[model samples]
Target: MDSYRNSDARPPIMQGSPPAMVPPRLDWDRPPWNRWAFQHIREILPTAEVWRGTGHRHRLE
Candidate 1:
């Protein structure tokens, strides 16, 4: 879908080799920027892996 986009949404914001409308570091949670920021958070922010499993099982009700 290289040439397909949803008409309801604004044209692509951050994309391409250099990307567009790169939101400021302090504006990711604000209007206009939040739309894209919230969608691609993993790529924009520094993150660490979390242990989501019970490493040691214990008897519980």
Candidate 2:
């Protein structure tokens, strides 16, 4: 059995180092940098759930 086949396996990204040698301000939609940015999206772009009402249920269209 291959080690990579294990369910716990997490493949190394950018050979297990930070994505760049001298990190530029990331474009975030490009390759390489996009990989790291996407992994940490929750930290970069925070979100909140909006409560519509307490006693009313909204119908889905």
- Enumerate clash totals for all models, in the order shown: 0, 0
Candidate 1 wrong stretches, greater than 4 Å: 1-21, 55-61
Tens-digit per-residue lDDT, 1-61, candidate 1: 3445654567667557475657789888899899988888877798788876968877888
lDDT of 2 by residue, 1-61 (tens): 6574686756676784654433235565467767767776665567677877778787889
Best of the candidates, lDDT = 1
Backbone clash tally (model 2): 0
Lowest summed lDDT across 10 adjacent residues in model 1 is found at 1-10
What candidate 2 gets wrong by more than 4 Å, as runs, is 1-26, 49-61
Which candidate tops TM-score?
A: 1
**C-alpha positional error of residue 21 in candidate 1 after TM-score superposition, expressed in Å:** 4.1
lDDT against the true structure, per candidate, is 0.78, 0.62
